[model samples]
Target: MRVRKLTFAALAIATALSLTACNDEDLTGQADPSSTSTGSSAPDDAGSDGSGGSDEEGGKGTVAGTGSNENGEIGKCRTDELEITASDATIGGDTEGTVAVEFKNGAGRDCALAAYAGVDLGTDSGMISAERAGEPVDTTILKDGKSIFFGVTYPMNDSGGSGVRVTSLVVTPPDETKSVSIEWPGEATLPVTDGGGSSVKVGPMGSAGQGEG
Candidate 1:
């Protein structure tokens, strides 16, 4: 009987030790080093790739039709926002006459003007063939209230004594459809011949204060 009691006591003590070990482990809350984290491992609002925010929300990048002049530099100049003017016509020679043309940006932003300005002597005469006089000019950027200038040289005399009758000059800015008209100076007439293959020449556009041709 005493031996049976000793065995029972030993068993009870062993069971108590096992329970205590389990309770200690539970209290410590140890985690396996190799186990992956179960809590949401997803990325935050910035996105995992790192490119975040939008111009629409006033964040990084340029907003459409607004922002710094550098950002708007790609936008073409609009006709409605441009102010076109022509200097007094000058007779360079019996065959050639030159006129200085200026385009001012009246819009409240910066814009790009490129290529050659389309020139028309009259409504029915169609567009006159023109070529750039010199090397290609750098792309012009016109800021608000700024202006760019170029020269247009045309024939002053046709095969006959009569010169090209130009009542008004129609001008179109580069890369634009809308055109503006300036009344031809009464003293100047192009010497180009009727049905002749002669062509007018235009110089590269440069900033204001550049000498006129």
Candidate 2:
């Protein structure tokens, strides 16, 4: 009878030990929710023209004009009503076309259009090319100026021929050559052609300043 009791006790002890081992195993080899990865491994999805890559991809925004320094402690100048007026552009049958570029001024100070403002053809990203137009525009600025115009080129629609995109219109006085940009109104609405006659405007692209909030 004692042996029977001992045998029953041993069986119970064995069952408890097995259960304890199982509990230990469950605790030690547990899968943790925090141990898993969560993110995508795909290629960076950028703008089709490879111009609209994210900040991580090294694309920020198009920079134009000098920054604002209202205090003038060697500060920058800013204007609220700098603008451009573009006429209908016609290209092809030649290596150029003609488009009129104008810089409309709304600043209180006298501002002239410099010789290096970019009137280019824009792409998927804010990439612009100096299309039919000639050199930098020359704005004739006076105090409370209005509009200044420059005539661009009339190039033929080559396969990779893009139309016209204006980067920036700037002004520099006689003493200083560093350009001060005229703020463009709205966004760039150019007509560009991919040398193959496939064309589109390069903008509504973002700028370096305030967010779209």
Best by lDDT: 1
lDDT of 2 by residue, 102-192 (tens): 4455675655433434444433446444422223333333335545444444334344435354555333322343544444332344445
Residue 36 displacement (Å), model 1: 16
Candidate 1 — which residues are off by over 4 angstroms?
1-73, 89-95, 123-129, 158-160, 186-188, 192-194, 207-213
Would you list the C-alpha lDDT of every candidate in the order shown? 0.68, 0.42
Cα-based lDDT at residue 47, candidate 2: 41
Return model 2's CA RMSD, one decimal: 22.7
- Model 1, residue 6: distance off in Å is 9.2
Residue 46 of model 2 has an lDDT of 36
**TM-score of candidate 2 relative to the true fold:** 0.32
Best by TM-score: 1
**Candidate 1 residue lDDT tens string, 1-213:** 999999999999999999999989876665542233433343453454355444334453444435675453368888898898887556445446677788888888878888577766662345555666767766777878888887777765545645556667778899899988887643445554556564677777762235322
